[model samples]
Target chain A: MKPVSVLKVLSIGLLAAGLVGCGKQETSKGELIVKIGSVAPLTGPQAHLGKDNENGARLAIDEANARGVTIGGKKATFVLIGEDDQADPKTATIVAQKLADQQVKGVIGHLNSGTSIPASKIYADAGIVQISPSATAVAYTAQGFRSALRVMTNDRQQGKVLGEFAVKHLGAKRVAIIDDRTAYGQGLADEVEKAVKAAGGGVVAREYTSDRSTDFTAILTSIKGKTPDVVFYGGMDPQAAPMAKQMQGLGLKARFLSGDGAQTQEFLKLAGPAAEGVSASMPGMPLDLMPGGKSFRERFNAKYGVIQNYAPYAYDAVNAMILAMEKAGSPEPAMYLPELVKLRFTGVTGEIGFDERGDVLGGAITLYHVRNGRWEVLDTVQGESAGKSK
Target chain B: MDIFVQQLINGLVLGSIYALVALGYTMVYGILELINFAHGEVTMVGAMVCLAVVGWLLGLGMAVPWPVILMLGLGAAVVACMVLGFSIERIAYRPLRRAPRLAALITAIGVSIVLQNVAMLVWGKQYVSFPALVPVVRYEIAGATITALQVVIVLLSGALMAGLWLLVKRTGLGRAMRATAQSPELAGLMGVNPNRVISITFVIGALLAAIAGVMVSAYYGLAHYYMGFLLGLKAFTAAVLGGIGNIAGAMLGGLLLGVIESIGAGYIGDLSFGFLGSHYQDVFAFFVLILVLVFRPAGLLGERVAERA
Candidate 1:
């Protein structure tokens, strides 16, 4: 009887604690505490990029809080609630639901398209705006989710620039393409394949690999038999770096090309000397060439060590959401959602605006090649005409 | 012809590492009849340990030669994994020896997961690069290139396998080990310490796995905490393909599996009319396993053993 009484008392106390924890009260007389969610793979192979995005969002939040933003006649304090999705789709949706339940007004991430596509619906249903900093799959925004948008250009624009450059600039007549089979990688490869054909280059081989694979010898050997002039990989640095090394080892003389996922500092480090002569395409202009890029880079580097990739876009994502909140005069998602869709500004990455389908408008793609262990810009292609071509 | 040669080279290199790892699984399974799932994590730990040492040595800015640094790293990885393997068996497996076989299997998995997460914490989640310790010198043969490292891997693996075969066949400890494998109780009655033999077996397996780990990291040019999972899985598949408790079977199975995977990946697109690409390489490995188990349950080189039940 005494043990049962003790158990009843413990259950009652737990229920009361849960209720008290769930209830929120605003304090300090019109000082609004706005919760913003940032989701990325904080732990995994892509953690470096994910952490860069988180740091970018944090820097924006810190700057906004320091400046003391005002929303609806109240002083606003932006609080970033960072969640690790581990770059997994299932984990991304769980994190999204958690953020939604936590009443976060906006989300500044989901770094990969596979995670973003599934999580976008959860955010939309919850009336929270999701501004992805790095997801590039075109299907992400084309899903008709009003709350979905991105600060960076989508894969369609980036892939076209890569394909045309491989043919017209690199003089590639026969091309080989490989993708990691992720939504983002496959989508970009599809676009690159189409653009290569349109640019009068023949695709000699099309191969697929998983994102987790490190061995590429068998596939590379198969592709080598075709003797393609250039080999393009649609995957992140983790897989791409190994492929590059293996290609070199196999005496495959074809030039290596990749999308923005491999245009990263980690790529150079992992691939070592094999990274030399590898060409890659990234969205947006060269960082130094962007409007506010130089100064922003110094500040970001001073705070976060080095920018891996997508940090500038992540910064702009948070800034755009905050600007929308300021314009709408409320931090509530419903109030700022419409303003966010129509917002336009010059960001660190250059002009930031979304089209009807939520893809960035008038974006640019930069081509780079690794030389002497560093990325050097080869050319920059504006996406306005490319967008029309799509 | 060039494609065939290139893929053969690739498959042999890949298979050699698998054979080293499968030997660990087969040895443990031979004696204890328990699948030591954590054997894979031990391999991962070996790689991570070696890389950490290499990174630390390079950071010291000492003028030690590259080969010296490579040897030192390999030495440290082997020693560390030997101790780790012993501790894992002592702490996780020995206590459960008399328990149900299922319990020991579950504990092995638990130890594996713990090792993976612990490695993730120590090494962080980034793919740590393995520096080019071995100088790259490629030789072109029939339009296919083979690096000095590839030749070393195959040669070293062959030497190690021959050495291991001699150890198991001609050594006194091998007689003790074989006796224990037959019956632990009878071996104990015959004055062979089963526990000691088992611990020694784990240490030897760890040594081979450590060397295999370093080879894989060098070959792939990067090491990650999760690298062990897939590598171990493939090696386990190899062991089963050769016949799970047989050492010779593991070796044969590993090389066969590797060649099968490489050639399958090379020709899968053609065989399936472009419907299935080389990404189905993993499928070929498991598919072979299924075919072998269905037709020849004892494996390619495995002998049929009567069940006690």
Candidate 2:
């Protein structure tokens, strides 16, 4: 019995030694490690776009790693730990707290405006830098959180551009507006309605639906009765695609317009031929036109097989954070955050800088028309650029 | 006037789907005195099964008639839902039959979550486009243009409901089902197989839900894992509106609810001076339910004692 007990003790000691040996792999001889947290709807309805945003951050970190970043006289390795928020505000706040607890040097994401707004408070309280890739709501940056910033242009700019395009370019005198009633959707729609009225277009009708609703037949019928020349929907692609198809089915002859949420390949695939003549907007320069966008797209297509919508913005977000950290000569959030607010760098999405409100400076909205079953850039309107041609 | 007719057509088309799903709720409540919250997930599974069968058959490039392929899809959906309904009863509900009502209700909720997650895994948690099997065209009816599918939905719903009414009133199986509902032990003593009768009743309800699910997918041209959640909720409201355990009441309740929602949405801005909009359509359904509960506690067609049930 004594001999058996000794054998068991030896085996246990050896197993524990082996397990300890397996955990830590040495890639750095005195190399400093910094983690950047990313949040998106990784497991739900918008996962395709969420994965695209995540891929952007991952690709940026890998490229940044290859360049061999050094801060505070120490070689640094950047890591991204992504959390799935389901594009939900509650989940966003919960994960925001978790990432703050993990002490990630900086953060990137909470992709929907609804989520980004709520989660920003948590990061601000924790003194962590948060850069949103694609939350375009006007109210997001308006909250005045020193730590909260976004790479993409907000809905105020997108809606103004879209409304102008519909009235002046499409030559529409009457417009109908519909929203999904989410914080993002309603905010965008209100802006569009305001812009439309300012652009000398008559508001014919207004309708709303829930995010979970599939049936829009009744609302479409009512909207059709108003006979507007253009109908704009402020919602995500899943609902937008079906609504587009239903509009055609209901014999509504008005042209369809939406913002970045409906401007996706999934919309083309889901809406089929109904997507042919629709118009939408994204909050950046066209990918091909941006200086770094071409190389980024090439590498991204090679790595992830597609660029949904926010990849370029996400890439810029990661680059912007790293630029701030490099400028500060530190990887700590508290040390780097002040520099992040004013850091100016040319990234894949364009020249990256922020104003007092943490909104991207010189923000632009790129208008797109679906031609030949693909998004064709119609115009690029930078706030300072005065209608640059796409 | 044309818009009003158009909305009415939309309401009826919507109502037909609601009526079919409501029957499932009403039937189970009639026979088992259980709510079966998992009933919605059963509908979701039915729709997904139909989509999967159709997609697989289309992918294989089989040169079959459209009608034939559609029939195969419906058949697949019905069978899958029946199997799911049976297992849910056997695995989740039967053991809890002798337990407290709260336990069974809690188990039903758990089963609902399990089905939703399992479906999310299988279907990939995104809105999948349900292909247009029918020709995409509309026919004008009284200044209201409606697709051929809408007419089919309305006609089919009426036929299904009528057939169900006849089956319950005039069939031997229906007699056994009613006997079991009245008193399971007494029915067993009277030589009726109570378990078998109950199982058949559950499957019958599932069959109705399955057909409704397929029609909804075709009508909307989209299907997702969570699609059944709201549809199930609306159907439950309809079930309660018609007296929880009544069959024809479910049909009437569904139609009335649909019309109310449609008209309420159409005229809400005018009614409220633009303070409220069509988005509040869901609110009207619950408001009616609350009003009915306040004024007529037994529901429109519900009896005081549930003696027939």
Best by lDDT: 1
lDDT value for candidate 1?
0.90
CA RMSD, predictions in order: 6.5, 7.1
lDDT, candidate 1, at A283: 84
lDDT of 2: 0.85
lDDT of 2 by residue, B1-309 (tens): 999998898888888888899999888888788998999888888899999999888888979888788889999999999998888888998888889888988998999899999999999878887766777778887878888888999999999999999888899888888788778999999999988887888888889899998998888777889888888888888888888888988998888888878888887876788899888888888888898778776668887774533
Model 2, stretches more than 4 Å misplaced? A1-133, A146-148, A295-348, A351-356, A371-373, A386-390, B95-103, B178-191, B306-309
What's the TM-score of every candidate structure?
0.82, 0.81
Considering only N, C-alpha and C atoms within 3 Å, which residue pairs clash in candidate 1? none
lDDT digits (tens) for residues A1-390 of candidate 1:
345434533563454345337534244475777888888887766889888999999999999998889998888878787777889899899879878877788999999888999999999999999999988889999999989999788899898999999999999999999999997789899999999999999999999999999999999999999999999999899999999999988889999999988998999999999999999998877778888888988989889888887888899999999999999999888899889878888788877778888888877899999999999999888777322423
**Among all candidates shown, the one with the greatest DockQ:** 1
Q: Which model scores highest in TM-score?
A: 1
Prediction 1 TM-score vs. true:
0.82
